[model samples]
Target: MIRLLSIFVLCSFSLNAKSISSNDLRSLYSKGQAHWPAIQTSDGRRVEPMSLLPVASPKPEHVALGDKLFHDVQLSRNNTVSCATCHERDKGFHDGRTTAIGIDDQVGTRNTPAIFGIDQWQSFFWDGRASTAEQQALMPIANPIEMDLDPKIALARVNKDKSYHAFNKSAFNSSTLTTEQMAKALVAFERTLAAPSSRYKTFLTQLNKNPQHAINSLSDSELNGLHLFRTKAKCMTCHNGPLLSDNQFHGTGLHYYGRRFEDKGRYDATQNPEHIGQFRTPSLLGLMQTFPWMHNGLFDDLAGIVALYNHGGVRPRPRKSQLNDPHFPKTTDLLIKLNLTKQEQADLVAFLRIL
Candidate 1:
C-alpha cells in the first residue's frame, strides 16, 4: 500500500539521514524513479523554471481518502458545501470568485487564493492566520461562513460513515476518525495539488542545455519580459526560490478598513500593530488560470496588477486606521513605481501566461 511504502521510505531516511538529502527524499519515495513530466538537470533531479520549484513527492494513501472527503459535501451542515467548493481542481484549485461564497450564501471578505505547494510554506492563509496547513484545515470547517460545522460534528459525521472507517484505519491506525487524523489527511492531500508542468518550464530546461538556441523557444517579447521580471520588475525578490514565494506578509496599501468590506489582513492574526494591512505574498504559479487578483480581488486582470506596481501604491496611506493608530504604516517599498512602458507590460503578461 502507498501508506506502508511511504512510511518505509521515511523510516529509511531516518535510519540513514546522512546518506539521503531532502532532495533525495522525493525520488526515494517514488521508489527511486519518477517521470515528472518535465525536463531535468544533468544530475537527474528535475527542474520546472516556470515555478522553479521541484514537484512534490508521491501522495500517501490518506491523500486519496482526503481527496474523497474534499469533494464530499457531508462535511457541511446542509450537506451542500465542501473544501472543493472553494479550492476546486478545474479552475486551478480555486473557485475563481472575488470572494469565497460559503454555506448559506455567505461571502468572505478576501479572495480565495488558489491552493498549491503550501507544504513548503512557512505559514498558511492570506493573512498568515495558521502556521501550518493542518491548522489551517481545521479553521474553515468551523467558520460560520464556510462549512459551518463544529469540530465535534465533523468528526462525528466521519465516525458514522462506514466507508471512512478504512481510511481512518489506514491513515490514523484507528477505527474512528479523530481531529488530528482528519487534519493530517487533508494536509497530505493538499501537498499533492501542485502546479502542472508548462511550456515555460520546457523552455527553461532547454535554455539550461543550449542557451543560444533555447532563446528561440519563447518569443523575443517573452524573453524580454523574463528579463524585465528579474531586473526592472525585480519580482524575484519576493517571488523567488523553488516555490516562487518568500512566504512573507506584505502591505500593498490596499487597506479597506471602513469600506463595504474591511479586512485587517495579518494584523488580525498577530496584532503586532506593524502587521495592520500586511498580507502573505501569494505564489505566481497559476496566475494565468486564476484571476481577479489581489486580496480584495478588485483587479480583474494581471495587467491591472502590473499597472498597480508600475504606478506604485494605488491609494495613499489610509487617512486613518480602524485599529485607531495615528500615522498608519506605509506600504512596502517594493511597490515603488516602476515606470514601465506599455509594450513592456504586455511583454510581462505574455511571460506570465506561459507559466
Candidate 2:
C-alpha cells in the first residue's frame, strides 16, 4: 500500500511539473522576477538577470604600472613565476592546470581562479579569506607554496626597477613607493580585464527589444540548454545574476573530509563546523575558457560535471570512523537529482560552452 501511494505521488508530481519556456524566462528576467520552480538560497537571494556594468576606467598610468607588475617575475622569490604565469589571457586568465604549480614546482591544493570580472567581486579566493583586492593581491606573493617572496622584498625590487619609476610615480603621485600603492595598481589593471560580450548577452538584448530575434542569436540546441539550465538542471539556484554566481558558499560534497583528499575548504578560514566543505560559488562568465573546474580541479570535462550534478552531486557515504564526526559535511539540499535526459545533458553542455 505504501509503495503504491509513493508511485501515485511521483506520477502526480510528473504531471504537475512544467518546463519553463525561453520567452517566459526572458520576460521574468526583464522585470527582475524570480522564474518559477526556483527557490531562495539560505540567504534569501534568488536568480536574477546578469547586469554587468561598463568596464571600470582607472587611470592609464595605474593600468600600465599594474600590467608591468602583473608580468614581472622579479616579484617572485626565485624570479621565475609572475601573476600572468597562472592567469594566461589566452586561457581565459586561468592556468589550465589541475592544481596550481607554484615556485620551485610546488603544487598547491586549490585550482587557480580566473582574474576576469574580479573587480565586481566582494570576496576573493576559494575560501573567501581576503575581503578586498588589495589584500588578495599581496597574499600569493608571500604564500610559501606560491611565489615565496616577502612583500618587503617585492617592494624593494619594484622600487629599484628603473622602467617602473615613471609608472610608480604616476600611479601614486609620489616619488616614494609603498606596497598599498602597488596593490592598487595591480587591482586597477585586473579590473580592466572584464569578460567580453557574449552570445548570451546578445540574446538577452534581443529579448528586451523583441523576443523574435533571440532565435537568430542562439541555436536550437543552445536555447534548449538555456531552458534546462533554468528549469530542470537547477543551475540558476546558485549560478545566477549578472556574474552567474550568487557570490555565496555552498557545499557540493567534494571536500573529502577525514580522507587523504580532505580539503576543509571555507572551514579553514572560519573554523566553523557549518562551513566544513563549502567553497565560494565561482562565476560562469568564462566557464569554458577555464578548465579543470572545482575547488580541487578534480573534473576537466563539462560532461562529467553535468553527470555529477545530474545525480545530485557527490554524496559520499561516511565511513564507520567518520560516522561519529559531527562536522561531516552534507551536500546542500538544493542539489536534488535532475533526471536530465542524455540529449538534455548535451544541450546543457552546449549552452555552457557558449558562456
Candidate 3:
C-alpha cells in the first residue's frame, strides 16, 4: 500500500511540472517571440528606442518669463504686435492666414507653422535655415516687417517695467538683461512645448506596452486610417516616427500662383543644386488648427492639399526629384492619380486632423 501511494504522488508531481512548463511556453509565444510589436520606422529601419531619448523638463522661472515675453506687446517696436499676435495660443500658436501679416500690415511670404511639438524638430523655418529654436526665436523679433525691434531696444523696454524687473531679479539674479538671455529663456520655454497626451500618443503608449493590447485598443476607423496612412497614402514615408516628420526637405512641385519663384528653399543654405525648390517637411501635429498649407501658403484648405498629393504631387515627372519621392507614391506612375475615392479622401483628411 505504501509503495503504491508513493508512485501516485510522484506521478502527480510530474504532471504539475509539465503543466507549468506548457503554460510558460504559451505565455512567451503569445507575448514575446511570435508577437512582434508595431514599431515606427525611418528608411525601412526601426526608429531609436524611446527609452534612449532624454526626458524633457522645464524650469518654472523660464516658463513664467516665457509666458510674459510671449504675450507682451512691448517686445514689438510699435507695441502693437507680440509673438502671440502671429502665434496665438488659442489657435495652436499659429495665426490662421494664408500668409502671416505683421506689425505694419506687412505680409510675410510663408504661413506661420504651429509651434507645438517644435522642440522635436531638428531644424526650423520652411527652408530650414535656422538649426535651433533659440536662433529661430530671434528672427521674428528682428524681422523688418515682423516685430521690427532692435534686440537692445526690446531688452530696454522690458527692463523699464517694474514687474519685469522683479521677475528678472528673481530669475536671473541681475537687474540688467540682454537679448541672448531673453532668447535662451524663450527657447527653454519652447522646449517644454510638447503634446504627449493626444489619443494617438495614448495608442502608441499602449502599443509599446503590448502589441496585441494596442491592436485591440484601436477603433475600426482608426485602424483603417492607420493602414491607409502606412500603405496606400504613403504618409509614413515622410511623416514617420513619434514626432511625425522625417526632418527632411522635399519639393512637391508646388506652383505658387502658377509660377515658381526664387524661394530656392534648402538650396540657398546648402548651395546644393539638387536641393532647389525643396522645403523642410513640416510636422502634421495640430493640423486642425494650422492651415493655409505649404511653404508659400498657396493652398487655403486641407482638401486642396490632399487633392494635390492625390495627383502624385503638383507636377509629376518621369524621373523623381530628390525630395519628391517621400511625399508621392512610388508604385504609381500616373501624375496625381491616386484613384482615392471621395470617402477615402475624407477619411484621410479626418485622420490628419486627428494628428
Candidate 4:
C-alpha cells in the first residue's frame, strides 16, 4: 500500500520538461514533501531527503575505539598527525587549506574533502578512487605526503596500546587488531560526522503542515534563487538528489593539463584517457561551511565560485605543442553559459547558503 502511494505521488509530480515556478515548487513540496521526497527535476530524478548517517548505530564500544584510533597521532610515521588534523570537527571536516598540508608540511595535490555522508557515497575521494569508506580510512595513513605510516605499522601501534585492548575485544571480539579492523573502526567514527541538520530541513517539515507558512520561511530572493537553480542555473544536472550530488565525475576545465598545476583527476585512477580532468561531483550538504571550494580548493569566495559557473566553468586552452594531442582534456558540455543576471547569481548563492 505504501509502495503504491509512492508511485502515485511520483507520477503526480513528473510534469516533464515544464517550467517549475516558485509556486509550483512550493505546491509540489507541500503535497509530497512528507520525507522531503518527490521534488522531481525536469529529468524525473527525485530530490532525495537529506538525513544523518551513522557512525551512529555501531556499538558504542566500536565507535569509541574508532574515535580513539582516528585521533591517535601514532598512526603517522612521525607520530605528529592524525585524521582530525585535516578533518576537524569544527571546520566542517575540512582543514581550510587550498590543498591539504600533510606530514612535515608536505602539500597534497587535492583539497581535503569533507568526510560527511561517506556511508552514503558511491565512491570516495575527489577522483572516486576508493570504493568504500573502510578502504578510504587506510589511505591517508600510508600516503607518504599525508601520514607516511604503513597500515601494518599503524595497526601495530594500535595493538601495542594497552588501553585499546578492551575496545578491540568489545568492538571486534579480538585480542589483537588487524589492518582491516582498524580501518573499519575509523570509518565507524567518521560516519558520525554526517551532514549537519539545517533550516531547509525544518522548512520541509513545516511545509507538510502549512504550505504558505513553509513558503514564508525563505526570503523572496532565496525562493527566486531556488527557482533559478532548478531552471536557468542548471545545477541539477550534476548536483541533485538527497545528497545534492550526482555521485559521478565531470571535467570542469580546471585540469590545467601540461601546466604546473595539471591534475588528471580520475584518469590517475582509471588510466582511461577519457577520464582525464574529471573529478567527482561533491555534495553541497555543508555548502556554507566547506570553503575555499573545488577539488583543488582554488576558489575562496562563494560569489566568485558562482561567477565561474555562471560563465559556464573554466575552459583552459591547449598549448601549441599539445594541439594535436589526443588526450587533451575538454570540459564537459554539462556546464553551459548560464547567462544568469547579477541578481540571479546573488539569489543562487542565497539558495546555496540554505543547503
Global lDDT of each model? Answer: 0.67, 0.74, 0.60, 0.74
Per-residue lDDT for 1-355 in model 1, tens only?
0010000000000122224443443333233112221221212322233334556664477897788778878889899899999987888888888789999999888788887876678998889989988899889899899999997898899889999878878777787987887887887788888665566667656655655455566675676565556545656556655666667787766766556555678988988878877888777666666766677666666666666566654455454443565536556665555666788778777877776
Off by over 4 Å in 4: 1-56, 205-211
For TM-score, candidate 1 versus 3, the one ahead is: 1
lDDT of 2 by residue, 100-173 (tens): 99999999998899887766677899999999999999999999898999998999998988888788788887
Clashes of 3: 2
lDDT tens digits, residue span 278-299, model 4: 9998877776677667777776
The residue pairs that clash in candidate 4, if any, are 48-242
Q: For every model shown, what is its TM-score relative to the native structure?
A: 0.80, 0.86, 0.74, 0.86
Clashes of 2: 1
Score candidate 3 by TM-score against the native: 0.74
Specify the poorest-scoring 10-residue window by lDDT in model 4.
1-10
lDDT of 4: 0.74
Give candidate 3's error at residue 58 in angstroms. Answer: 1.9
Candidate 3 structure quality by residue, lDDT tens digits, 1-355: 0010000000001112122333342343246213422432223444322221134676778777877888888988999998888887677678888779999899987778777665678999888889988789888888888999987788898888887876677668777567877887787677666552355655566666675565555444455444445545656556665566668777655423113433656766787766666778776665656765667665555555666566555553434343544333122121234555565566566555555
Model 2's alpha-carbon lDDT is 0.74
Candidate 1 has which clashing residue pairs, if any? none
